[model samples]
Target: MYISKKEIEVRYAETDQMGIVYHANYLIWMELGRTALIQEMGFSYADMEKDGIISPVIDIAVSYKKSLHYGETAIVYTWVEAYNGFKTTYGYEIKTPDNETALTGTSSHICVKKENFKPIQFRKYYPEWHKAYEEAKK
Candidate 1:
């Protein structure tokens, strides 16, 4: 499978009172990873948006395995977990500098018209993009 990697530097402001990275930060990291994955796959979310479509997350789930601290670099690995004509699920793994898994998750999204929020047939709307995802998910 085609997996994309992105490195994020944890900031002090991103930590909780306990000095550990806040849980919600994982969602942001997933988005960064997803953006990288899309770029790696030769697609751009911006282009899709400019074409009057926007992909919105429908579901998300994350599991915390280890605590991430400030001043540390986190590497996020992203890949296509599932894809169909209607929706796509992106998988993610955030690891610490020491190579320990800090979090794992998946976010599901569906493409819709930006104007009316109506769902689109992704395969028909972007055949090449859909085929690329299909090949990557293999």
Candidate 2:
């Protein structure tokens, strides 16, 4: 599998009252990881949007294992978990500097025509992108 890594410096704003990173912030980190993965694969989500297609999240699953505090750094690992012609699922793992997993999750998305929100096969529009996902998901 092709894994992309992104390092994030936890900020105070991402913490809760108890000074630990809030649970919801991990979802943001997952997005960062996903963007990094796509960029690593030589594709830009912005370009997809310019083409009048949008990939919206259809499902999400996340699990928290450890708490991090402000000033700590976390590394997010992301990869394509599954991809079909109509949908793609990205898997993610957020880890501490020591490589201990703090959270794990998957986000599934489907491409649609931005004008009418009709579902579309990603391969029909972006064959290279679809092939990349197929190759990476192995």
Candidate 3:
């Protein structure tokens, strides 16, 4: 499996009065991780957009294992969990600099037409992109 990692600094604004990183911040971290993964896969999601393909998250699930505090560096680990004709799933892990896992999550997304916003199957539209995913699937 291919994995991508990115580091991010936890800002004070990310924490609540209790000094714990807000739950929502993990979602942002996941985005960062996903972006890195896409780049590592040799594909610019931005390019996909320019090509008239837009991928939008249909669902996400996150579980917190420990709390994070401001000023700490976070390592976001990401992977392309699964890819199908109609949907793709990305997995993520957010951890501290010391390798302590703080969160685990996954997000599901679908590619659609940019103009009409209609769903598009990978095999039917971008066969090469789908092939790369299939190669990685092995």
Candidate 4:
């Protein structure tokens, strides 16, 4: 897999009263990981919007393993888990400095028209994006 690594520092605000990172914060980290992976492929969501394209998450899932507390550093491993004509799956692994997994997740998204926010086939309008998805499959 072509993994994009991003370091995340656990902050007090990101944690709940129990000191463990808030569950919802993981979703934000997932987005950060996805953005990093896409940028690594030489593209940006901004550029996509400029081209009148939009990609919104259609489905998402997350699994928490170890608890992460404030002051610890976590690494997010992100990649294109799978893709097809209209859907793309981005997978992520969030771990601690010692490489212990804190979370695992996947987000499924589809490219769509910004004006209508309607789903569109990536192969037709975003061949480069589709090409990246295809190459990543290997």
RMSD per candidate (Å) reads 0.8, 0.8, 1.5, 1.1
lDDT by residue (17-132, candidate 4, tens digit) is 98889999999999999899889989899998899998989999999999999999989999888888689998999998889999999999998998998888898888887888
- What's the residue-level lDDT of 58 in candidate 4? 91
**Where does candidate 1 stray beyond 4 Å?**
none
Please count the clashing residue pairs in each candidate, in the order shown. 0, 0, 0, 0
Which run of 10 residues does model 4 get worst, by summed lDDT?
Answer: 129-138
Indicate the worst ten consecutive residues by lDDT in candidate 1: 129-138
**lDDT by residue for model 3 over 1-138, one digit each (tens)?**
778889999999999998889999899989989888878877788998998989899999998998889989999988878887788898888998789999999999999999999998867777776777776652
Candidate 2 TM-score, true structure as reference: 0.97
Ranking by lDDT: 1, 2, 4, 3
* lDDT string, candidate 2, 1-87, tens digits: 999999999999999988899999999999999999999999999999999999899999999998888999999999999998789
lDDT of each structure? 0.95, 0.94, 0.87, 0.90
True lDDT of residue 113, candidate 3: 90
Off by over 4 Å in 3: none
- List candidate 4 stretches off by more than 4 Å: none
RMSD of 3: 1.5
**Poorest lDDT segment (10 consecutive residues) of candidate 3:** 129-138
lDDT of 4 at 132: 82
Report the candidate with higher lDDT, 2 versus 4: 2
